[model samples]
Every structure is written in structure tokens, then in C-alpha cells.
Target chain A: MTGSLTLRAGLLSCILLTAFLVVWHLATRGAGVAVEMDPEYAALMGATATQGVSAMPGPLEVGATLWRHLRDPFYVNGTNDMGVGIQIAYSIARVGIGYLLAVAVAVPVGFLIGMSPLMSRALDPFIQVMKPISPLAWMPLALYTIKDSGLSAIFVIFICSLWPMLVNTAFGVASVRKEWLNVARTLEVGPLRRAFLVILPAAAPTILTGMRISIGIAWLVIVAAEMLVGGTGIGYFVWNEWNNLSITNVITAILVIGVIGMILDQMLARLARLVTFPE
Target chain B: MTTPRFISMEGIARRYPAPGGGRTTIFEDLWLPVQRGEFVCVIGHSGCGKTTVLNILAGLDSPSEGTVIVDGQAISGPSLDRAVIFQGHALLPWRSVLGNVTFAVRSRWPDKPREWVEAQARRFIALVGLAGAERKRPAELSGGMKQRVGIARALSIEPKILLMDEPFSALDALTRGTLQDEVRRICLDTGQTTFMITHDVDEAMYLADRIVLMTNGPGACIAEIVENPLPRERDRTDLHRHPHYYTLRNHLLDFLVTRSRTFRDSPPPGYDRRHPPVVRPGAAPQPVPVPETGDTLPLAQFANRRHP
Candidate 1:
């Protein structure tokens, strides 16, 4: 039943895409009415003024630009110009490093908070205050303190990724069934062994859910952080294309960003499924 | 008495602070002893703190007042020597039947090789009649099967005393009967000392060697301890056919329905916390001392009257 549902959904998506592309093609088709003008002024004015072509790039233009970028994705043209793949790679690398660093800090600290009532109460105020702050709001301080644009962007990613996972891990650990802990106690399982074998396994699904949310937030924040830092990332690429007024390139970057974000979310979702137990 | 009993609770009491100020006692000055290989089931109404007593015995929860002594040693906390089969079955849902059993086996014998631990677990699993379902997770199993896994896990550790908190109460009647039969056979065959808590009188009569009755709570105490009159080798299906079955069952029912509520307020004359009256409900009536206090009467008089 699910398989057939998925197939039908896929077909519907294709139909929607086709209809969108056809509408875009017709809407952007150049107006046949010609304006007589000075050749020199008309050359400066370009296609929109001379041929009455729509300024917004049509689906065909975006597709052609996407294919071109895909054909030579990793080429670096200088300090200012780089291929789409390199920009995507830089963004992923930053998110990966910062997110991994967040994981290292969040999970263990979350465990400590979850396990100890004193620590949980002590840290709760700080988490509550910091959780609502936007990741980009920290960019100014990060750049000031870290004194490096690239590192500042990573710091933002790390901060944005930290809260969801930390809160989730703590919640998960704190809420493990009392009966399971009683089982461990009765078995005389040592504190460390109990934490690893029983508590960790029991809390893993919830922790992974936190991680899934963190990764998505990290992906989102990295784009804005890269835009602020003016560095080599997909977010920077989009900003740069917008500055050059190349609507085709900007649309292509948006599509790439979306696809990469989806892939990252899917990977974490699969990981969450692996740890989730039925009961 | 000669060997200091295999398990003993000495004046253990559990209490929680009430909303206004003073503490509300669940049960207090509770004392009980079990000889080795004895199967004792505590029967009580919902608020009587039977589970709290079982938890105290298991060392999962410490009594607010006194200590529990097992095999000459006072229990400091939960120990490997006492294994609890929880009411909810409490199987680690992520683990398979074999894994759950193996977890306990490994805990009991940490240095044992993987093969040895798994083999020991498999033996207990089969002993609980779950041999072929080793790979099934708790979520995949029926309620009865999950509880069977719990029994297997508890038994695998070979604890000196097995503690079960209404292990079969959640199961359907048919499954409860089958599991009870299997557990009775397993406990009897292995000579495992067990302390169980349940509200089911028939279950107490069928499985327990002695059924300890507790009054309704707010300061519950053991009202009486009725010795089961059925033979040790009795079968579940034919349990009702026994001559003493109805007598034993009715006495327990009567205590729970009426006496349990009034027990704390008006305990029988000569009722002792240290030694509650031990009555064999189906036994012939015997002469007993009359009460000195006009307001109090001996509870045993009613038990004897009910049967005779």
C-alpha cells in the first residue's frame, strides 16, 4: 500500500513540475512588439528593453544554467569565483565540523544534566535564555572574538546546532522508564555500565531525534552565516549571484541548497530510525 | 527461627509527607520472615502498600524505618541476590528475548564468556517455554510472552530470592493461567524463594505456600497470614476441585472485602505486628483464647467459623 502511494505521489510531483515549467515558458516568452530605439542605447539596455524579454529567468534559462554548473561543478576561477560543487562542499564541511563539535559537547553535558538534578536545575536557566537567540545574531560577536570570517561562520553553525540536541538528550535521558532503571539496579549493574548499556540505548532514539532537528537547523544557519561572513559557501554563492544580477545562477544555488539540505535531513532521519525501538 | 530465617523484614515502614505537614504512613512496624524455598504472596487492596513492601524486600526502595535482612546480611540497596519481575514486565524493548535474558546472565556472571552467558540465558528462556522465540523483541511478543521473558530474565540470575510485583495481573485470563502454571512449576522445580504481591485471591491460593493479607492503607499492617492448604504438587485446572480450595478462597475474599478496610482502626485483640496470626482457613476449628478487650475480637475466630 505504501509503495503504491509513493509511486502516485511521485507521478503527481512530476505533473506539477511539468505544469509549472510550461506556465513559466509561456509567461517569459518575449513580446513580439518591437520598440524602435537608438542602437547604442538599446545595446546598453539589453534584451529586456530591446526585445521585451521578461527580466525574471524562465525555467529553461535556470535549467540550462543548472546543467552548465553540473558539467563543471568543481572548477575554481579565482578568489572571487568558484564552481557550485566547491561552494556546496565548503558549506557541508563547516556544518559537519561544527555539528560534530556540538554533538561532542551536547550529548555528554546533556547526560550529566539529565542524570543530576542539581546540574539540570543549574543549567536550565542558561539554556532557556540562549535557545531563543538567532544563530546570525551571534555572528557579530563571533567575528569580533574569533577574528576570522570562516571560523565565525562555523561558530554560528555550532551554536545553532547545539540547543536542540542538548535539550533533547537531556529530556530523553531524564524520562527513561523507572522500571528499566530498577531492573538495572536489581542486577547490580555498575553506574558506568548502567549508563552505557541501559540508559544510553533507551535514550538513543530521543537523542537522535534531537540530532535530526539540530542538523536541519545547522544547515539553515550555515547558509545565513556564510552570507554574513562573505566566504566560500553555497549561501555566499547565492549572495554573489544576486549581486551580479544573474537570476539564473541565483535560482540554481537555491535549488542546490534545497537538495543538499534535504539529503542532510534524510541521513539523520535514517539514523533516528535505526535507534528507535517499538514499544 | 533456628537458622535466623532465609529472609526477614524487621520493623520496616514506608511513609510519605502529607500535604499539610504530618507524614502519612503506608505501612509501619511490618515484620515478616520466609524460610528458604518458601513461596509467599502478599494479598491486599489497592492502597495497602503491598508493592512497596515487595520493593523494600527487593531493595529497590528502602523502608523509611528499618532494614531488610536476607540470608543473615542486612540489604543496603538493590543487590544481585534479589531479582525483581516488575508488574509491567519491564523488558528492555530494544532487546530480543535472548538479549534480555543474556543481559541479566552477563550481569550475574560478568567474567563468563559470551557462549557461556548465552547458553545460560537460552536455558532459562526454554525453561519459561520461550525457546523458539529467542530473536523476538518484547514489542513483537504478546503480553503473555513478554511476561514469560521477564520470568526467564529474573530466574536466569539465580537470585537467592525472586521478587515479582503482580507479574501476571496484566495478562488475559487464559494467558495468566498458563503463565501461572509455568511459573508455579518453575519455582517449585528450582526451589526458588519468591515474594510476590497480588490482589488475586485465587492466584494467592493456587501459587503461594502462605498468603500474607494486608489491610487498606494510610497505616496498613498485616491483618493475618493464611497458610495455603493445597498440596504442593497440585495442578491449576484441578485446583478448584480440592476440598480446601473454596474455604481458603472465601476467607481471603472476606478479608479483602471487609476486614481490610477496618483492620487499621480495630485490629483484633492479641494481633501482633511482629507475628500476625497464622491461620489455615480450611483446617478444623480449634479452641482459642477470648479477647480481654470488649471492643476487639480475634480474627481467627471468623476464619475457623467460616470453614467449620
Candidate 2:
């Protein structure tokens, strides 16, 4: 039942996406008339009239583009373009590193903050100050400090992803029921053991939520970082396509970036549910 | 001294800081003594520090004024020898019904095989009528079942003294009765000392060998302790049918309902309990000293009062 329900929901979303795209094209199709179906506009769209297609390639075109990107990939990737898969892998790898680092550092720090009032009060202002800064703003500073573009991107992702997780971890640990702590004390669980087996597992849901939020921010920041760093990533690919006047590739990259982000977020959501099933 | 009383709270006084700036004394000069294999219920109105007293016994909190000695030793913190059942079932949401009880047993007895721990947990689940619910988590169970799991978990260790803080106050009448019966039977079977805090008048009259009633909060003192006149083995359904049930119930209700309201410093409506009237007052006065547990009331005490 769960599988079928999810499948039905997925199909429904696709249908809704088609309807929305149709409406979007209809609103903009008349733009072709305004520009007289100019050949310049069709540089990547392949002369809309010649292909017997609308200026904006219908749902079928996007679907074909998506399928080709999934199966054959490169030959269909773009006009003078890097493969969409490579662009996606670049961003995912940076996010993976930055997210892992964030978890490694944030979790321990958060546990201490939650366990000790002095630590929480002391570190709270620093966390509050750093969490809200824009990732691109950090890119220039990181680039100057690290003197390496790739590492700077990683640093940017790390900074962007750190706080949600840290704050959530602290909150989760703080909210662990007192009775459970009493049980741990009764069993003679030491401070470290209590943090590991009792408090962490008990607060796993909240911590995972923080992780989810952090990963999302990390993914978003990597895009901004790649654009600023001017490197080979999904963000760079979109910028490169725009500069080369390949509008189809740009649109395709936009869709791919969104879909990949959705998948990553969904994976985190699934992990959260698995840990917090409450049974 | 005095066989250590199994569990003794000698002049325990807990005073938590009041809001803003003031010390709120919930309990002061409270003397609680429990013998092994006896069941005692601490009955009081809200904020009487019954739970505070229970926490001190469980070693989760300390008394500001006195010591809580358990098994002839001072208690510094929680230990396996004493188990506590709070009002809400605190079962870990991530674990299964069997897992909840098994977690306690496993932590305490790491060397025990998995099968043994699981078997013991399953037995407790069945004892709480959750045989088919071994894999179900706390969320999947009803409120009563969750509390039963709490009870089963407490009993699983076979702790020497079980501390219950209104464990059944939230349940409806039917489930409450069934679980109360189960609790009585289990205590009878194990002979573990129990100290429970509750507000139910009939419960205090029914289960406890001794019911310690406390005054109002903000200096909640142990006003009186009533010993149940009936035997522990008496049929619960027919318990109130005994001639003395109404009398005992009314006497306890006076302390909990009437005395509590009057203790708030409000003016009384022409009632004086400090000195019993020579002639019968408007309301028929209850007998002063109800007979203690495991003892018969003298004919002289009952002679002054009628069953009605």
C-alpha cells in the first residue's frame, strides 16, 4: 500500500508538472511572434520552424531531453556543453564533503552545548553570528584564505551547512525526556555512554532534521559557490551555457539541478523517518 | 537500627526555588518509613510534593533537609535496586514494546544472552496483555497499554522497592480497575515494597496498608496517615460493600477535599475539627482514630458510631 501510494503521488506530480509547463509555454509562445521567430533565438532550439516545433519545445521535447540525459547523456547534453551528469556529480561531491564535515564537527559541539549550560551560553552568540551570512559572500574570503578554488568551495559549503545541524542537535539533546536519563543513571551509564546510547538515539529525530536542513543549505550553497568560483559544476555549466547562447542546455541544467536536489532531500527525509518511527 | 525500615526517609524536606525570588517548601519534616513487602500509598492534593518525595526515594532528587536511606545505605543517585514508574509512560519511541522492557534488562545484565533477555521481555509483554504486540512501538499502543508497559518494565528488574507517582490517574475507570488488580496481584506475588502517590480516595482506602495524606502546597506537610482497616486479600469489588467503607471513604475525603480547601486560610462555615463538639454537630462527626492495618478495631471505637 505504501509503495503504490507513493507511486500514484509521483505520477500525479508529473501530470501537474506537464500542465504547468503547458501554461508557461502558452504565455511565452506569443513572444516568438513579437520577435518574428528570429533565428538568433533558435541557436540552441534548432530553428523552431525547421523542427516543426514550438519555440519552447513542448512537454515531449523536455521529456526526450530528460530521457536522453538519463540514458545516452553526453551526445544530447548540450550545445558546446559539459555533460549534465558531470555537472551534477561535481556539486553532489562538494555537498557530500561539506555536509560530512558539518556533521562531524557540529554533532560533538552540539552535544556539549546541550549537556552543559555554560557551553551553550558561551558558543551561542558565535553560532548566531555565522549562520545567516550568504554563501557567496563567504566564497571570496574562503578563496583568499584557502588560496584554492575547490577547497574554498568546500569551505563555503561547510559554513553554510553548519548551523542548522548544530542548533537542531542541541535542541534534540536538550529535549530528551528526563525519565530516560534517570533510567540511564539507574543503569550506571556514564556521561559518554549516556550521550551515545541513550541521548543520541533518543534525540536522533531532531538531529536528523537538523542534518536535513543543513544538507539542503549545503546543496544550495554549492551552486552559488560554483557560480562564484567559476569552476566545473552544475552551476558553472548553467553559466557557461548562458554565455554560449545555448538556452536549451541552460533550461535542461535548471531542471536537472532541481530534480537532483529533490532526490537528495528525499533521501534525507527517508532516513529521518526510519530513525523516528516511534516504535 | 529498627531493621533500617527497608526504605527510610528521616525528616526529609525538599524546598525548590520559587519563581522570581523565594524558597517554596513543598515538604518539611516529612518522615516516611516502609518495611519490605508492604504497600504504602501517599495521598494528597496537588502540589503536596508527593512526586518530589517519590523522586527522592528513587534517588533522582535529593532532600534539602534530610537523607533518604535505602537498604541501610544513603542514596546518592538512581540505582537498579529502586525502579520508578512516572505518571506518563516514558517508553522510548524508537524501540518496540519488547525492546522497551528489554533495554532495561539488557543494560543491567549485559552478560545475559539475547534470547534470555528477549524471553523475559516477552513474558512481561504478555503479562501486560501485549503478547501480539511484541514488535509494536509505544506510539502504536493505547494509553493503558503504554502504562502497562511502564508497569511491566518496572517489574521486569524485580526491583526491591517500586516507586509509583500516580501511575494510574490518567486511565479510565475500567482499565484503571483491571490494572490496579494486576498491580495488587503482582505485588502480592513478588512481595516488593511499594510507595505510590495518588489522589483517588478509594484507591488509598483499597490498596495501601498505610495511606499518608499531605496538606496543601507551599509548605506541604504530612497532615495524617490513615491505615486501611481491611485485609489486603479482600475482594476489591466487595471492598466498599463492607460496612466501614463509606465511613473510611468519607473520612479520607474530608482530609483531601474539605480540609484541603479549608487549609487555604479561607474562613470556615461554622465547622471546628480542632476540638470535637460534645454533642453531635450539624454534620455527623467521623471517628477520630481509624484502626490501623492488620489489626481489628476495638468494639469500643465502633460503639460510638452507627453504620449509616
Candidate 3:
């Protein structure tokens, strides 16, 4: 039953793709009459004016552009013209460093909050207030304080990634089953050892789930943050393509962003699976 | 009497603040002594604070009022000398069977080498009949197997006293029976002093040397301590056929079903809180009339009836 369902689903996806492509092809088949004009004038008028073509690129045009980008994904053709791979790599690296920094800070602090009622209650107001503000809202403050545009982009990722993980780690640690804690208590396991041995393992799956959520948010925020603090990233690439009126390139960047985000989410999903227990 | 009681509870009471204001007592003025190598089970209805008494003995919780002295030292908190087997088989899900046992062994003897810890853990795991399943995580194991790991982990610590809170209550009947037998055999072989809280009267009878009964709570007391009349070598399959089996079973059942509630409101006349009466139901000397406060019979009357 499952196999047949999967087969039908795959067939439906292909049908949908074909239908979408057919619609795109028909929609962008420009109907305006061609006005014979000077070659230099036509060049100045851009590709859209050549034979009165529509400015919007069709699926075929987008597909060709995607193939070209794939061919030399990591090419470095000066500041404004680096390959898609390089731009994606820049975004990933920023998210990676920022997310790791968040992990380092959030986990221990979260442990403290989870383990102690005092800290949890004490910091709850700050977390509650800070968590809802958009990471992009912090972009101006980050640029002013940090001074580096690249670092500012990373700061947004860090801020965006921090809360879910911190909240999750705290919830996970605090809710560890009383029986397990009692088992450790009766064994006379010291506080530090008990934290590492009992609480850490028990809370790990929840912590990883928090991490997964944070990474997804971080990935989403990095794109917009990169567009704001434009140096070199997938988000910047999309904005740059839009400026150049290269609709095909922008669409390609969108696809790449989606794929990379999925990969990032999948990596954390695998890590979550590793720590999750059957019970 | 010179060698201090192996374990002693002196006027221990547990209370929680009520929603309105005043405290609600779970149990109060509780006093009991456990000699070395004794297997004692506390049997009571759900609300009678039987677990509270066991938790106090394990030092997992503080008594609102009294002190628990184990092997001479007054317990302020949990100690390495006491190990608990929890009802939920609280094995660390991430750890394997061997890993769970080794974790306890290492906690008890922090100075021991890794190999020594593993060896000690393996010995206890084997003792619980889980020798070949060492690498299996708690999730992969059956309920009975998980509980066996719990028992193995408790015994691995080699504590002065074992505290079990319905350790086999989660298992099926057959599994519980087998685990009970295994626990009894291990406890007997090691001469381990244990305090367990259970609702199963038959389980208490099969495993406990003395069954401590608590009246129903909100303000509970030790109703009486019933000495197990069956021999140490009693078997589960033929346990019912023992001459004193039904008498002892009926006594515990009667207390749980009827007496536990009534006894809390109206304790026997001349009932001493400091020294609750110990009765060996099938072996009571005679039908002694209820006595007034000063006319109470000495504990020696029932003490002489117990088998060595």
C-alpha cells in the first residue's frame, strides 16, 4: 500500500511540474508586434524590447540559467559576479558560526535556567520580551555596534537562532522525569555527574528538536539579513539579480535557497533522530 | 540491642500545605527499626504515604519532622549506602543495559577503574538474568527486561540497604513472579537489607520478611507490622499451599480492603506511636483481649513467636 501510494505521489508531482511549465511557457510567449529598430537602440532597450519580447522569463529560460549556474557553481568572477555556490557558501558559513555561538551560549545558560527555578523565573521576562522582536529589527543596532556588515548579518542569525534553543533546552532539562532524577539521587550521584550523565542524555532529544527549529529560523532570517547587509550571500545574489533585471537568475537563487534550507533542516533532523530514544 | 538498629525511623512525618492554609499530614509520628539482612515491605492503599516512608529511608525526601538513621549516621540526604529501584524502571533511555548498571557502579565507587566498573556491572546484570542483553538500550528491551536492568543497577551499587518502590508493578504477572523470585534469591544470597513499598500483598508475602502495614492517609499511621509466617524457602507456585498462607494473605487483604480506612480514624486502644504493635497473624499466641493504655502486652509476647 505504501509503495503504491509513493508511486502515485511521484506521478502526481511530475504531472504538476509539467502543468506549471506549460502555463509558464504560454504566459511568457510575448504577443506584441515587432517594430524594426536600430541594433544599438534595441541593445539599449534591453532583451525585453528585442522583437517585443515579454520581460518575464519562461520556465525554459529559468532552467537554462539554472544549468549555467550549476556548471560553474563556485566560480569567482570578481565582487559582483561570483558563482552561486560561493554565495550559498557565504550564507551557510555565517549561519554556521552564528548558530554554533548560540549553541555555546544558550545550552549552558539554558541548563542553569532549567536546573534552577530562580534563574528560570528571573530571566523569563527578558526572554519573553526579546523573543518576539524580529531579528531584522536588530539589524540597524547590529550594524551600528558591530560596524562590520558581514558580522552584522551573522549577528541577526545568532539572535534569531538563540531563543528556540534556549527555551527548548530549559523545558527539556526541567521536565526530565522525576523517577530518573530520583534514581540518580538514591545512587548518591553528585550534582555535576548527575547533570551530565542523567539529565543531559534525557534532555538531549528535546534539545536537538530546539536546535532544529532554531536552524530553520536562522536559515530564513539569514536570507533577508543578507539582503539588508549586502556583501555576498544567496540573499544578496537574489537582490543583485533583481537589480540587473535577470528574472531567470533570481528564480534560480530562490530554488538554491530552498534546497540549501532543506539540506540544513535535514542535517539537524538526522542529529535529532540520533539522540531520540524509542520510549 | 547494643549494636544500633541497622536502620531506624524516629517520629518521621510528611506534610503538605493545604490549599486553604493548614498542612495535610500524609503520615505522622512514624517509628520503625530494620535489623541487618531484613527484607521489609510497606503495604498500604495508594494515599497512605507508603512511598513517602520508603523515600525517607532512601533519603530521597526529607521528613517534615523526624530523622532516619541508617547504619549509625543520620541521613540528611541520599547517600551511596542506599540504592533505589523505581516503579517505572527509570533506566536512562540513551544508555544500554550494561551502561545503566555501570553508571550506578561508577557512582558508588568513583575511584574504580573503568574495567572494574564494567565487570561489577556485568556481574549484577548476569545475576538478574540479563547477561547477553548488555548492549541493548532500555527502549529495545521488554518491560520485564527493563525492570531487570533497574534491579541490576540497584544491586550493582552494593548499597547498605535497597529501596524498591513497586519495582515489578509495571510488569505482567508471569514476569513479576519471576522477577520476584530473582530478587528474593539475590537478596537472600547477599543478605541485603531492603525496604520496599508495594500494594501487592502476595508480593509482600513472597519477598518480605516483615510486612509493615499503614492505615489510609491524610493522617496515616503504621497500623501494625505483620511478620511473614512462611519459611524463607517458600515458592510462588506452591505459596498458596503453605499452612499459614491464607491466614497471612487474608490478614493483609482485610487490612487493605477494610481496616486501613477505619484504623486511621480509630487506632486500637493503647496503641503506641513510638512502637507500633507487631503481629504475626497465623502465629499469634492467643486471642488477647483489647487492653487499656497501661495494660498493653509487651512486644516480647509476639517477638517470641517469630522464627529466627
Q: What is the Å distance of residue B211 in model 2 from its true position?
A: 1.1
Per-residue lDDT tens digits of candidate 1, residues A124-190? 9999999999999999999899999999888999999999999999999999999999999999999
Residue-level lDDT of model 2, residues B1-308, one tens digit each, is 22225776667798878798988888787666567888999888888888889988888888898777676577888888888887987887777888889988887677899999988888877887878988888998888999999988888887889989899989998899888888888888888799999999877777787777677886766655566767668788799787667767877777787776565465234423321112111235433432343113222233334551
Ten residues in sequence with the least summed lDDT for candidate 1 chain B:
B294-303
Distance (Å) between predicted and true CA of A246, model 1? 0.7
Q: Enumerate clash totals for all models, in the order shown.
A: 0, 0, 0
Model 3 per-residue lDDT at A6: 80
Model 2 clash count equals: 0
Q: Which stretches of candidate 1 lie over 4 Å from their true place?
A: A1-3, A38-41, B2-4, B285-308
Error of 2 at A225 (Å): 1.3
Worst 10 residues of 2 chain B by lDDT: B273-282
Each candidate's lDDT (Cα)?
0.89, 0.77, 0.88
Interface RMSD of 2: 2.0
Estimate, for each residue in A86-127, the C-alpha lDDT of model 3 and write its tens digit.
Answer: 999999999999999999989999999999999999999999
Which residue pairs does candidate 3 place in steric collision?
Answer: none
For every model shown, what is its TM-score relative to the native structure? 0.94, 0.83, 0.92
lDDT of 3 by residue, B1-308 (tens): 33236787878999999999999999999888788999999999999898888888888889999787776577889887888888898888888999889889998889989999999999999999999999998888999999999899988888889999998888999999899999999999999999999999889999999999999888899888888889988888898999899999999999999999899677788787777887887887232334454213233222343432
Find the 10 residues in a row with the least total lDDT in model 2 chain A: A27-36
